[model samples]
Target: MILKPVPISAEQFTPFGDLIETGSDPIAINYGYTERHHDLASLDLLEQEGRPIVSIFRSTPLPQPVTLNVMERHPLSSQAFIPMGNQPYLVAVAPAGEFDASKIRLFIVKPGQGVNYHRGTWHHFCLALNAVSDFLVIDRSGKGDNCDEVTLVEPITVDLSDCEESTAR
Candidate 1:
């Protein structure tokens, strides 16, 4: 199956997770030097002695016509990925429970946008485009089998020809 990615938005991505982006209404803090987009995502990490951990993920871009054979989910906690650079990326996700390959959705995440997958939402790993990128990953720690992976019956191919041209080179 071939998947075309659409631009990420909070409304379209609500079923799977939260779209982390700066909203128009941001509160000014630190003597107006910082504008805070508060409460963008709800971190669900309080189950089974789970604690939140922050880490930096340096991702290398995948080859053209990216194909995905497997998907995973964090059953114990939500996972959030915030890009550290202005590089764009792709996000593939399916709703929580019962892995269904046909239900998978693809999204093109532009610069200044991030994603927070709700607990149990099946998702592919970070897909950096154009070049190597870094993301601030926030997820659960100290869990009992938080990760669940399933091999797709059929691989999904993503067309990125348009994405390459649109994103920063």
Candidate 2:
């Protein structure tokens, strides 16, 4: 299977989770010295069985034409990634349920954009493009086995060169 990444936006990504983007709507706060895009995403971590953990992930960039061999999810908590700097990345997601390859959608995550995956949302791991990137990760720290993985029967190939071609034209 092959997938093409679509441009990401807040509205288009709502079904999976929140899209953290600060557009032109920030309000001044803290004695008007701060611009706050407050409460942009529902940072959901399962409270009944686990404590929330905050960590930083420094990921090396993946080259283009990547192969996606597996998908994973956390059943007990939602996961979020906030990039440390402006960088483009790739995000691929499928709805939570019986794993279906046809339902997967790919997005080109632009700079200044972040994602919060709803609990149990199946997703590919971080695919940083162009350069190494750092992200602030928030999720659960618990006793339960929350992580789940499914290997695809046939790995999906994702080529971003087509995207670049369209842009260049």
Report the C-alpha lDDT of model 1 over 43-134, residue by residue, as the tens digit.
99979998889999999987876899899999999999999998889999999999889999999998899999999999998999889999
Q: Candidate 2, overall lDDT? A: 0.85
- Deviation in angstroms for 52 in model 1? 0.7
Error of 1 at 132 (Å): 1.0
Which candidate tops TM-score?
1
Q: Which stretches of candidate 1 lie over 4 Å from their true place?
A: none
Clashes of 2: 0
Query: How well does candidate 2 score on lDDT at residue 156?
Result: 93
Task: Write down the RMSD of candidate 1 (Cα, Å).
Answer: 1.1
